[model samples]
Target: MFCVDALDVAAELALPAYFFFASAASDFAIFLNMPYLYPGLPSFKDMGDTLVHSPGMRSVRAVDMPLSVQDKELDMTKTRMYQFKRIAEGRGVLVNSFDWLEPTALKALADGVCVPGRPTPRLKEIAHGLESSGHRFLWVVRSPPADPADVFQPRSEPDLDALLPEGFMERTRDRGMVLKMWAPQAEVLRHAATGAFVTHCGWNSTLEAVTAGVPMICYPMYAEQALNKVFMVEEMKIAVPLEGYEKRMVKAEEIEAKVRLAMETEEGRKLRETLATARKMASDAVGDGGSSEVAFAEFLRDLEKSSMENGGCNN
Candidate 1:
């Protein structure tokens, strides 16, 4: 609805409108494939939490699908599905990501995986991961989804002592630092000391990780994030995935293993090197003579051309 509104306003004003996807191209591929994937998918309600293999995309699972799609109860075509479907009507879709950063995932998108990009789990498992992985961690813990009734009330400080397992914080106190959710995310990512990120598979966060040149421990919670995780861990070969992560209870062992793979092991080291290259590539794509810069100029030229054709809104 909003996309169409933008299109309508642009057309009314005799202007050209471009759609920008603020995520990875791999994820954008999935959005493009959704029209095909949705109908072909097995009844998610009947087979709750099962995986459905799709052509040119990663397998989608029932559980991680958003309420907007998985709920047979809702009229999906009238909602997010419709909104995404309308994206095809735009002049062009610009993804806030680069090509080399997600090569395999992008190839899969080109050859066939239109995968894109969750939610989160409890704190104990995370605390345990930092402890057992033997890696330094800085966790920014957000309050769980707010209840609508209390949404307006100012939140109180989280009682980490009670929230985490007994003595968990004490044990890892020196090794890990658990901060409030509002901590400076971009700055932290830009910091040199940050080795790896344990992230929630959001697109903005993914771009941040790319810019900062950090590997990840992907623990997707819900929505199309499962698609993002699959692309990164299975296809892109960039981040490590947390096993049994979708189960809502990630055991300490699994968490620790993934953390180590992202932060301390040879695999972690290689991931860091890959990320270093990606950082440079991302950096180059934004400055003078960058692909993004060139593309933006071309798009503007096209827009101006369109305006001239329409009797010069910008004339």
Candidate 2:
């Protein structure tokens, strides 16, 4: 929301105003509705670190929510709630996402994705997990970020050799490719050689996976990525997460299991099927007549119209 003084100026100048949200549709929905949900969720503070479902979405937990929505006592939270409530007053809202990704939230003013039921063995786990479970894979081992701020952040900026287990490169040398430098992600995803992606669930990464029709092993870290994980695993049901390590850095065993899930299980087969559908939808959304294209056109129309009306106000 614009400031009162700014709105007053806009009104005096006879200018149209609009708000742009950079988060996922669900994130905006939760923030917009926080004023109503806050009173009922007063018990949240007492809930500690327990998983409490969010009011705006199915299967999303309190821990997945942004601090702006959680800390009702904080001045910033109050300001956030106030601003979110004002979202509707804008001429129109423009979201930087596509419809297929968050259909429920966007349509019903809600988001949702995949994985499999308990009865099946999931992608029989990643490369390591597959080997452990007697399966095969073609893995691409990328280098650690130069400054990874979250889990698995290497100590003292170690080389790829030091970061990975001893003899791992040698052992998987024939079966996999250890790419220390950058690999072309889009090209890799588009390649038929690619299968599952063990991702951190960043929106961009998730979208790439969806477009590639690749199932994911969700390893969320810092910020709204936790919310993305829940949407992918619980609501969307296209990805699986390592137990007891969604919020923290995972160790070898958990990593191995997830790899197995991605590579060998019946659950994985189902995940692939769901990803195929999501991939098509994501492709369609970005196609000429698709949602993303349409949304972008509408957003441009509003901006152009506003520019014309305000004679391009100079701040």
Candidate 3:
């Protein structure tokens, strides 16, 4: 069925009408009234920073949000108009995540979390295989350059084959895979050969690793990633941090030691077990009769009833 806002359009047709809010409609309205509250400049130079500030946005740096939200020249009037348009034409909005992953943000959104319905048996199989085979795994770091000098530079900074310490790549070449850009993270985490993830601890990546029951070798770049590392290593006991990266250049020996610790150390083994329990809990929270699932279903029903009563839904 087709949906539209504006009294003129709705009155002209007699079809089922609905409204959906992609973000928190009230929050957006409040934010729109205070455009000047947003910072004139982007905050940190990393994705995690932006996401961290998303829940409590207030005079936040532009870099801490999506690029479009940071554009100074974009007309706020037009942005609000488009936002309202989208909200006015759908039955309900669904976010692309699960509740256990972001309880605070999801609660604020007041929208349903549409967890994908899949067994993830492959992930389990891979984890089991890795446990049995006792292999070493290394996660090549993939991130945007932090230095301004490196920012506008071309992609050909160095070959994966050239950046390693002497004989380091040769020594682990049989067990390693070097990747640029993004990795098929869920797939890799589910792979039988992956014993650990050497990561920047981006929230999404961290969640993926945690959900897969894998331990992390955290190399936080900026923003909440650093904060998340504290929780992962200190609170959750599921990840470890690389300490000497204060200079930001991760040497081969440092990488070698951390990777080994994450894979074979006694502490690392304990972390794996802890993550396994967390993984199961997360799975249960999103399962058929779980809290997230029930909340989502209720959200849908509310939208439906609201649409019937108001001739359209409300955010």
Candidate 4:
């Protein structure tokens, strides 16, 4: 929850508090288990080829662990993971993920998983991949940061021509459209023409793509996104992983291959079909008398009872 730190205040007031985790259940599973798992392991930098076996998901390579712990000092990592101990103390936790989408991870919590920079070279490779895929596509391009640390710093608008592969735009003109800066992401995902999504596997985008019935090409750039990629591609079977992402340079050929697989092959079709079912399941879960609706009603009831017991905040 945005007010996670306020749990102590709520406890002092005898008020119940809940945590709203914005990521996947798999990530939540990892968060809950971190206090138990992290203290025993060596620094992530020293964990080469050692796979971490957390409950509810597959073993993950040390390199695929969350960026916050990957390079931080051991004490800092302990501090970060220790938050979960408090989180576990909360009345409950809510996640922005669906039940059908993450059974294992959800079961683990219930359960509860890089960093990369956006630079010019990676964008060019993405462009080449799009061009070579020969599929209809829409891309939103942003100018790369001058410094990796200043990724959010605003700058001049993107110059697609200078950033993309030479002749790439002209070659893909008929089959693709590239927009600058932003797009109505939700609307675009819901569009009938959107066959697949090439994404960084951010939780918001991952859920949107799932709801839209669009399969994905998981190209995680940072954060727990690599973990999301694993759940989506390996557990959910709703996406295909973009190879070479861990190396921080996803090759053009790898992108092309994933694109073609998601757009043209039988496997891709199956992924789409799986997503269609998932979309309906998502709808049902949130619809009237659905799981989400029932849970929300229960939450409101609990909130109301808690408020009354606390004397309606007058105390």
Global lDDT of model 1: 0.72
Provide backbone clash counts, one per model: 11, 26, 5, 6
Off by over 4 Å in 1: 45-67, 103-119, 147-156
lDDT tens digits by residue: candidate 4, 57-144: 6777787777767854666576676676667777777887667888787666651221011003389888888888888889999888
When superposed on Cα atoms, how far off is each prediction in RMSD?
4.6, 7.6, 10.4, 5.3
TM-scores of all predicted structures: 0.84, 0.72, 0.53, 0.90
The 10-residue segment with the lowest total lDDT in model 1: 111-120
Task: State candidate 1's TM-score.
Answer: 0.84
How close to the true structure is residue 164 of candidate 1, measured as C-alpha lDDT?
81
User: For candidate 1, lDDT tens digit of each residue in 1-315?
Assistant: 236568878877877778877666766666665665677565565666688665455665666554446654467544666767667666766777666666544566556444233105767777776787887778877665556334345666777777788987778778778887577888998999998888878778877888899888888775567667777777666788877766677778888887767766799898998888888988999889997798688888887887788887652
Q: Which candidate has the top score in TM-score?
A: 4
lDDT of 2 by residue, 1-315 (tens): 325245556567777766666656766665556555666676444555666544435645666665445567778667776776566556666666677677656754622111011000122133345345333344444444456544345534226555555566677666666554356776777788777776767777787778889899876655567677777887677899866543354554676777777777899898999988888888888898998898888877887878887777545
- Output candidate 1 Cα RMSD: 4.6
Ordered by TM-score, highest first, the candidates read 4, 1, 2, 3
| TM-score, prediction 3 | 0.53
List of clashing residue pairs for candidate 4? 1-20, 27-113, 28-112, 29-112, 108-111, 109-112
What is residue 1's positional error in candidate 4, in angstroms? Answer: 4.3
What's the lDDT for candidate 3?
0.52
lDDT ranking from best to worst? 4, 1, 2, 3
lDDT of 3 by residue, 28-64 (tens): 3223222333344332243333433333222333232
